[model samples]
Target: MAPNRGRPKNLYQFHYGCQLFPTETRTQKQLRLALQARTQAETGPTLRRNLNRSNRSVKAAEEPTPSHPQTGTEQHDVLGFNEGPSLWEDTEEILNEEDEVSRARLRSLHQEMIEQQRHRNWKDVMACLFPAYLHFKKLTSNWTVPNPFLNLSSEVCACPVEAYKERDVDLIDLMVAAIDVYQSLKSKERKLTQEVTSTDQQDVLAQQSCPACFGVSIPNNDSTEPASEPADNHQVFICLDGNFQHRHHERASKNYIGIENQTLFVPSQDIESSNSEIREAELAKRVTKKAKDRCAEQHKAADDRRNASTWKGCDDTGLFGCCCRHDSVIAFCNIHKTGEGRGLPMSIIKRLLNSINPNVQVGVLYDIGCTLGKFFKARGLLTNHLLRLKFATAVFHSYVHDWPCQLQFNPRYNNGWGLTDGEGLERLWSYLLPLVSPLRYATRNHRISAINHRSLFHNTLGIENIVLTLKRKFIHALKTKKESEGIVHQFLQDQNPHERGQKYTVEFFRAQWQKQRKFEIEISQTNREKKAEQAQFYKRGEALKSLVETLMDSLAASPQSDPAQSLSLIQQMQELQKLQDEEAAKLGSLFVVEPGAERD
Candidate 1:
């Protein structure tokens, strides 16, 4: 706690009897206890085998030191053949594609590639140290931390075998490469298992998609819900949004290897193509300079300022991600040196459409769905695919749009959205928040690979919990439907019948919605002066309402206040009264006399 010394106060408390062996630090003690617990949790036979070996899985309790590192001779070397599943025969290789090769050599080659990549860029700066845990626990069955490959330079720090060639972090990065390979092989094995039980043809969408959202293969014991329904359940709803937190600083890393073009991401070239299209439209005078509404203009200006200025030193501005309704990542693309353009989401939608079955309905919900829908329809882009797709703004975000936009594009007002709020990708961004800082300095390939890995893990978890997710969603929808129907019924009952004995039925409200939509669309197109006048009226009305609410809040904020705070509150009320008087003057002497004026 001392400022100048800035060291733990308890550092000198521990005393050792002798220095024959290096004493365990806090980290080592914790790790040893963790490993010892794991050893105890194992079966009795495995525990006996581990106990027989002097250096076994629980070796962290007593790591070999720099003075006398552990060594293996042919006489004492631990050797065994752990047979891999026959399905590994078809799994893809890291860099090698040659078949019928030794698995050990393939592993060696993979490790070599990981080392080369590590040394080339992240040798010192960004190498991942040996993490506290591995990605997959299955690998831990045969894993040992105190292996000969790792050198315990001290109780605290670790180095690799080649005499300080790599730090513990580098060893961790090396291990990630092995994990990546292991994960791929396990996925292949899983897909083979699915093949035995599944009847339908398999593809990326069919395999990776959530069973609840798309359709389950196995029967739901509940029995009422359909499992053998059409692919994508007749409609595919996706959430699209931009996140600037996952940007990369240009000065942090330098590599021309280009980002990996994989299933998890849309290629940079494809997104760049959309950007080019936007620029060309502007040049050709096909794009309008006028914004659709004040909200649209404000949103665009804010985006422009954020993307252009906030990340001047960064090459990647952010990311544009698309996720299915069940929060499974469909695809995402990196935004390069620019704010999100119309090109990004449009390109991603085109990509999604091209991937899914053509006949199925596709609903895309984004933050600015109304504006994007207009832009798409005006440009006549994606002509062949547009017929089957519809656009809606996300439920929470729709309020940010003008009333007209909300009426046209908000899922709450529109049909077919079904309680789908379209905020799934926001949850995804929260999942990637931890990667934000590290990825800003990571190599481009590593950044993409890391995101892909995280997304894969998230999707795997989504698949595992999909049935529960569907059950929850169904319950929520049913509850909401009942409450809404009751409220509507009560409202209808409360409405008085007209002189002609005509009731204000649900059909009447539907007709009113249609009429209001038509009037708003017409007014938006033709009445600029009227729109401005109406905006001012709404602004003044909101000000008055806000002033009333503020006064009420301030009155209740401190019912038992002191004299000085009481004086402050009185002055605040006077200021509010003065503003109200000014607003009244703007209303052309609506009040009898000037309010809040001096009595004299």
Candidate 2:
């Protein structure tokens, strides 16, 4: 083809200016030349602006809008492109079309994505695809943030979602971790707040003290003082009304007058108009004194009744029937039935009773371990007024033995007196001996010896039995005076000191003497049995010795009686027998030895 028509002046001018004075750096220019040569080689040849009218219109449509002539230089610079005006404009149009397509595609992708990337203009497009997208975003925006209690770390989030999804543990696990931290912080806050509130309330409650009786002083606004005091005796001062005060005074005045008085001693004016308050005060003092005396009498009567009512009982059927009294009445009452095993101290009993009821009469004494019937019999006799009217009627109850077999024999008693035999005698001595002696004596030397002696005496006599006897004798004395229908003094007068009389009559002594006699007879019988056993053992020993002697005599009288020959034969036999005995002894010793001993 003849040289194609040269490009139009505008197109040629554009290409010539780009090639002659390229806008790109040297490296860029070289790259562009290489790209241009590659494109030209692929296409074979090309001419500038070779287009039909339809092509021209489409190309023009692809171009970007021209910058406005009135636009400022800064606006023009911001709009600058590396390519010429037409190419730059075309690229801008393509970019604008691509953005529009992306925005349109996002609307159909997901409403959530559209909202997340809200900067793009997708509202119109999204409304077409999803009508409720905007509303959903608005409603859920506030709740979008995850709970802080949940452990929503990336690793946790990426775990096997299916495993936890059906179980609901994922959310619970998240909440649990989050809540632990939250509660720790919240608990500290709550504790601090409670402390502050409690302190405030305590301060308020501490301010007021009792206004009456002065028994309790109200706390000052800022002072720390206890609410009550024992010594305070101040009377309460109430602000009484005039009418109340008048009534009080009238009552006081009436109380002061004698019951026989029919009329006022003074004129009505003097009696009614005179300040009644002064006379009322005097009347009050007399009434208070009378009331105090009545109260004292009531207290004294109560104490007397208590003394008469307190008593215990025991039986004296055993060999050892010596009367013993416990020091503590209350302890006796508490552990009274404890017969041979553990005996309560009379002193401890007394203290405990006094502690429980201070009005208890300590002088009204009774041994805790006594037979039931004897105690009642004593009570019946001692109740008479003619026999030692000042002393209160007292009874005794017996102690029980510790061992079940002993307790079975003495069923009425419990296990408080002393142990049967001497198994736990040492323990009992350690526990009780100190209590019996004076504190000073106990603190001094020989404490252990004193305790052992007490235990031995107690064990031998059966402490419960002894305590019962003394209680019985006292009761008997009272009974004799009652039955004789005479005062205790009169009964004593009847018995002459010259007649070798007992201080107290012994109505129950026969039973005690009989028991003692039986005890002696039993002891003698036991000794006889022991002697018989010893004789039998001696007889057995003599029989064994005689049998051994008979065996030796038989051996000595054997056959072969030639003096030298028999002696030699006997010597040989003796040697043979000695050897056999030695082997047998060794075997017997070894067989008899115990396995344990062998190991040792």
Candidate 3:
């Protein structure tokens, strides 16, 4: 297209011969052209040329580049398509891809195992079996190998350790192999079933349907599917406490070595900040006072020695000290530790709660349950976990607590705890004493393992006993019910002819309620009378104070210069003391006893 002669001269033109006229005045057109020229100068051919100088510099900003440039050999490290094919590398990649697929399949199988309740520790069991499977496969290379399900235990026992060693297989390796094998078997079975079902459907479809009707009725095969297991509502009771087993450790006194060393104290998280600070200040003050007293004693002794022997060379020796060895353990479920033992039990409790099913009712019995409850309430710790928790003290421990504490933490009052449940930890300790001697001689790991194994064995036996007891109870209940039903029926038939006893009547219940109300009123009246008497009773402190004041007054009034007057004053003070002792005896007669303070 040709430019129009009638258009403004201040217009733009393209290389394709397209022309555009300016819409603004001459000054605006000039300014627009100037701006365009400046922009072009800033980001035009020169800028593009600069960026092109190093393709790497621009690309490097967008992506990572190695610090040291690669040589030809380094670049060729990874096999290229142009190079000869590497069978081993290709095989490795294929195997890795297969392994990933197998792992996913195995996870599903493991979940199935757990859901079926076939095994609690399916992975560990499989780990122990996989090496045997491998050995069997090697031996039966020319022949067909039987499935592990036939006799997995026997195979495991027969398989040599050498087979595992040859393949550099460990327990973990065995576990992985087992998973892969299970996954493969499952996939193969699934594929075969799918093929069979498909072929059967095709064959049925190929045959002519009933001429009169349109559909063929096939019997449903899904009726035999196993019923799903119910959710576990088994209640678990766990007791936690510190058991101080005195095992000698070489490094028990490592932190308590020298005279200048401060007390081997660990700041506790359970203690309030103010209380901790006060304790620290008190300890420091006591240490300072002790040091002063020691210095005074030393100086006095030195002076005495100098006076006695007419001193020689000055001796500058100060006090020397060594450390003491005594270790204390705080344990829960036979798992013990020696350290700052405050929060260790709390951590173990938290872990135990988390691992169990959320619906399980957990009753924790501790010796200091009341104190722990107060601490937990104050701090709002374990708030999320208290939903199904029942906190109680052990039966024996509860006897030592105050009335209010017993009311809150006594297991007798707690409906969640079963008979003898709270005593489990105590029973475990009794069993543990026999095995604990080994801990003194064994390594730390060995001690832990021994305790754990013994605990496990005890738990297993306890479970068996519980199961047997329940079974026996069920049988006894059935037999007793059957035996009593006939006699009860005959008795009821006989009683039907006569009126029921007055004990079952509404009047009897009304009378009982009235009697209870009267008893409660009487108790309240007694409590009120006791409280009033208590208010009139003189406190021991007040009685002592009065006696002291009277003696002070008598002493002040006496004339100190005259011996007769002083003697009389002394006799008067003695008489006052005698009177005070008699008054104290009277006050003690009305002493209110604190609960649990009575001697056993």
Candidate 4:
């Protein structure tokens, strides 16, 4: 019998395991065309039906007929052919044609399936089976060879059995080899794809030219400058806002128009002026011509100076000290430069200054707010000439006094203090009175009473209202002092003169005052404690002096003793001195007796 040359059993097998994997071979362009044709065919019939229905009479009058001779011939040939199976001929021609077509379609489908199966097998072997086989070989090679069932190709019947039996190595080494092959293949594919895509893109770009360059034609001229080098600033004038002369006119004019204002001009002679007088006159004219320009330069310079001063003073006194008299005065003026010209109130200025220098002690000699000025004036009446002279000297000595106290007093100078009201005002007054009195006059006398009076006054009557009332009252009282004196006299007369005013002479006054008054009780508890500490300190000093004398006597008497023993004695003396120092510190006194005594 002839050897069976049939397909393998695996090929005929149902493959109930799963369907064959499909391969990606269809071109995107072909699929897209097929989809478009199907959509058009479906829609065309509906469109034609609608057209015929809309014009039924016209369609009936124009009968349909074949346009070409082959159209009718083709129809007749199709109808004349055999339609069914014939017993005599042993074959149905129509059936045979149908079978042939069916066979051709089956053949095409089988080819597609085989290609898909081959691709799937290649991927599975490369990605899954090969890696697994390599891993098994690496682990098993060190031991006795494993069974032949471990051979993946033999089990899958995908690759030759001889290939499966090939010796294995480390999985990583095998994986590296596979990876190198994959990378090479992938690189080639990418290069080809990129070449095709880039070519297509370049063609597209070449076909679509730039509209501007395309619409306008210019003859080639060697005289023309290269496009990369733009026209000089004088030649090219571009008005971004669009209302201006063209490029040619712009080059001729050599001056670009500015918004609202025309291009400024300076005569060549004015620019070339060499004489000092001419230069000075030109400079003055330039400044006078544009006040804004001159003012801006001056303002910028002033700001730079102020900033330099601020940096210089930050280490010594902080930024507040850098403020100039003009700044304070301007702040005080309350003049709204940019808006409505309304001056700020004097009280507002005071609040502003206090806010700016809340922690610093500022003298009141410089302009302070009106209320503070009046308060200072009132205190000045009580102050003696000697105190005033000292105050004047102190003000001269320290430049802190030169600062504009009045302008600094404004709340506007302080960050975020302008909106403070009654409670905030009271707190500010309390804080400022103490700060001001300490630094202002340099007087030995305590201004506690004066500070308290001002604080209480501001607290009870608002600062502005108090100044207003005082002004009104002072004028009225000056005009009518006799009436005020009478009221005062009546009150004074009502009290007994002996009880109202008691006079004491020196010697007898001291005896009576000392005897009648409880002086000891008047002494502070802290003072009593200090006195006790002094007594204890004296006792400790006596004890320490005795101990030191004994140590010195011992050392002098034992001069022949071992030097080491003598040194040890001296160390003990030093330790005692240290103990004395620690004790003295507890009592708030230095242990040293002499002012410049050397401590050992």
Candidate 5:
């Protein structure tokens, strides 16, 4: 297949300047990769610097002293994988000199391959989309029409289709590509016409918000309304989370850069800036050798303690996402080296807020929202928009936080939250879970595009059935409200005696919640629930000790020495020890236990 000259008449005729992937032969990919490898080898030492390895090699080369014997630099982990230089910090730059060199080389090679002056034959056109496949409507070719389907569509299901389609491994990818291209083209056309699409990049809600939430929110009185509340916007719940499972390996693509930028993702440059800004600020003053939120440092995601070493083979270790209460896909980005960190979420949140009206009240629900809220305030992030935002933990994960944290951040305990669970992203992750393993080996462009495309599909389906969603929510809420009210009324009518002979009313609980919130505010981030627990621990321990001592004295006085008596005493002692242990745990839970702390 000889390549034709002059861009091969961009058959799709995209006047909006939208370019599709060209067809290409295996020769092109092979040649391009070969040249890239040759360039890297030519500039290898300087471009691919290995400071740690070089230092080890140099030390081994030198004469060894009796006190310090020479050691092999080559080491393997328990898994028998070599422990090479992995990106230690989340903020490490991915595009090094070698990366840039390879990227530039590929770009130049593509131009040369497409317009190879002499040839104008079928063989040279091997890379273009095969089947000369065109979206019936858009006429975009899958390949320029020579290129071995380099980008494989991610399998949402692991079931093999080789038996059905024969040996063209990327057949599924080819078929999916046409549909994806059509959808993208369709969306672009809609955007141009100013038609509302279910899948919007910025997630700008052109239509009305969820009916139950802010649609009919009552307007506060003039005096009580926030100064920034221009027209009494109802509260918006935005959930942010990170999924470490959605990662792609560095070896997946060879010096290839994805040309089609995915708008669903936060821009990489913005990611870098957020990371740099946060680092600079922390370095100057707020740097904590000992992080205030140890759980945050230990496990970035909620309860999932997958650390840096977990993704030794991957470049993108995870993803950070932001979404509305309806579980619609909003802005998200591939988290560089870290699991769940401050940079990506903050960047996404700030961008979403900036894109829309400042008057829109946003409540951000994260697994560790209470901790993040404090961090944001301390770092002076979102300072201007702080008034419009409320931070809260998702309902399911709220139990992980102490009572004080629950009072402040748990949606269930808070007023105006209604029935928002804040676990929307968790459900969203399940939808994308199928893309995890397959995408780990796919190209960077393929990974991002696949996620964005799938997310778009999710939103489209969600929008189409939004009315059904509202009806179900309304019915569920009504049932829950009735059942809860019945229980409350039953308790109110009960003759059960009160603790202090005082009546408990709804007003009493409301005032109590306000008082609890005030106390939480007065205390620092670490101090919440710990002081109360500590006091309780000492008081309980003293009482238990006194009781044990009194029982032991009584036994001694009787001088009882029977087998049955000894067994009874042993049982009683065991119960006391268990009680003491539990009381001690209350205090222990407040502090962050470092690795190997138990052994120490």
Candidate 6:
């Protein structure tokens, strides 16, 4: 290309100098500058002028600047390429405008990214909902109405969407299908009801019962009287307890027709100024007395309530009724906290008792047997059925009670309970908690609905009955004479057995029980002796005081009393005083107190 005439002359001149004396070749620019200055000082005006010219030339070659023909402002360019304009030469207004545009572009891009991410999240949610709905549909397919989805909109079928987009008809159909399925599988009479009503409906004809379902073949309640058995055989044993569910956030109570009916009173937060001094004093006295009385009553009730137990940290009470006979939950209620004792569980127990035959002995087992026992005994409601009623404590809970209580109420002593204890209720709660935990935060109605459905499903589904049926079949198969003979032959085929048969008879258990009773008796005697020893000290002190009083009375009557009698009285008094001093010293040392302070 031809050299441009408009280009700066210094640009070509600087290039020529760079070719001659390369700027980077010099180790130190400062050294070069110093040498030029020294030569300038030694030489004449011509040499000084040349050195000054060279110094300017070298600096220009090291960091050369190019400028536009129109604007004289120095500029930096990439190689020989010319950009439109430099910020150094541009006006401040133009620079500010560019910066503002850049920020706006950045913000727009950021918003677009966020929108894309949100759309992706919505799609994922819809995908999950579709599979869940399909699962529900599959579960209810057997009982669902014909062509439940026939009336669906094309848009609904086109893609997975949010629940709100579905037509009301579809939602209603889904709900109806769910209800139908539940009803089909559920027992005709809810939990133990058929048996309860069998007595009243004796006129009804006997019908074949389905083996796969939880049903009874008997129709007449007249035969409801349990077959005569040993006193140790019980028709049923039920365990009861309460479970409390916690809330993440507290909400104000909603008006409902359920059990929680007590009106709660909250103290006023706002305080008002009082004018009368005498009135305030009297009011304060009354308040203090009322508070003290309330505290005393609460403490007494707390001590009494140990006979029954409630779930820890749970304010809401679940009065569970578990049948130890069947190892299943028979009935449960979400009970309101009525009073100190387990009023709800007790009521439920009575209801359960009424459902069964009056002649059938029923044993009740619970965590708090002591409290329930006292309540049941004192209520007079069960006085007529007292002979049929037996109460015992759960094995796991017996250890927490006093030794006397353990001996009386422990399941080990209750032969009627047999092998299975009352812990069936505890196991039921464990299975139920995980299923209901997620629904807890929902409305109370929703939470209760879910729990009721699960409980009912477990009861009517025949899971236990199916297992029982299989067990009976297996036993029948094994009971055949051929099978029994074959098994016996197989067993005898072996020359020797690795393990021997172990058997424990009633006599063995009876002997063990006798030994246990004797030990318990010895323990009681020891306890009584220890208590008597404590009482003896107090009794001696009291006797000495009485003697001293009598002696003084005699001395008053006869001023010249006998010295020996007087001395004896003094010695007794001294002994009593010494005993009191020793007791006080022991008490002071055992308990925390201020240093040097007398216990009395």
The most accurate candidate by lDDT is 1
lDDT of 6 by residue, 512-597 (tens): 78788667656765676556556765676678779878888989999998989898888888888777656545545443345798
How do all the candidates rank in terms of lDDT, highest first?
A: 1, 5, 6, 3, 4, 2
Angstrom error at residue 326, model 2? 15
Model 4 clashing-pair count: 12
Model 1 Cα lDDT, one tens digit per residue, 283-380:
56576655455555656523666557777888877888988999998888888888877888878887767765556688989887777777766666
lDDT of 6: 0.50
Q: What is residue 303's positional error in candidate 2, in angstroms? A: 48
Ten-residue stretch with the least lDDT total in model 6: 262-271
- Of candidate 5, the 10-residue stretch with the lowest lDDT total is 11-20
Where does candidate 3 have its weakest 10-residue lDDT segment?
Answer: 319-328
TM-score of each: 0.58, 0.13, 0.35, 0.14, 0.57, 0.41
lDDT tens per residue, model 2, 274-381 = 224323433644323132222123232123234332212211100101111221101111111112111112222222232222221222222222221222233242
Tens-digit lDDT track of model 4 for 281-325: 436545331322221232322233444433331211110111111
Separate clash counts for every candidate: 2, 55, 0, 12, 37, 3
Best by TM-score: 1
Candidate 5 ranges with C-alpha deviation above 4 Å: 1-187, 193-204, 207-232, 283-291, 294-298, 302-306, 495-504, 512-600
**lDDT value, candidate 1, whole model:** 0.68
lDDT of 5 by residue, 1-600 (tens): 322343433322222122334655567768889999999899888745786688889998998569866655454333345555553422323355655565566656665555332123233442243223333222324345455354343322355666344454767755754655555554455444434543342234433223233333344556766644246465678888888889889888653344356757888888889878777777766666356664354344633345767777788888888778888877788876666667877898878777655567888888888888787777677789888888888898888776666777789988878898988989999999999999899877778888888887787777778889989999999999999999877766544354465556666666767887888667875574566667766675566667667667767878765657666756766786676577666656543344567611
lDDT of each: 0.68, 0.32, 0.45, 0.35, 0.67, 0.50
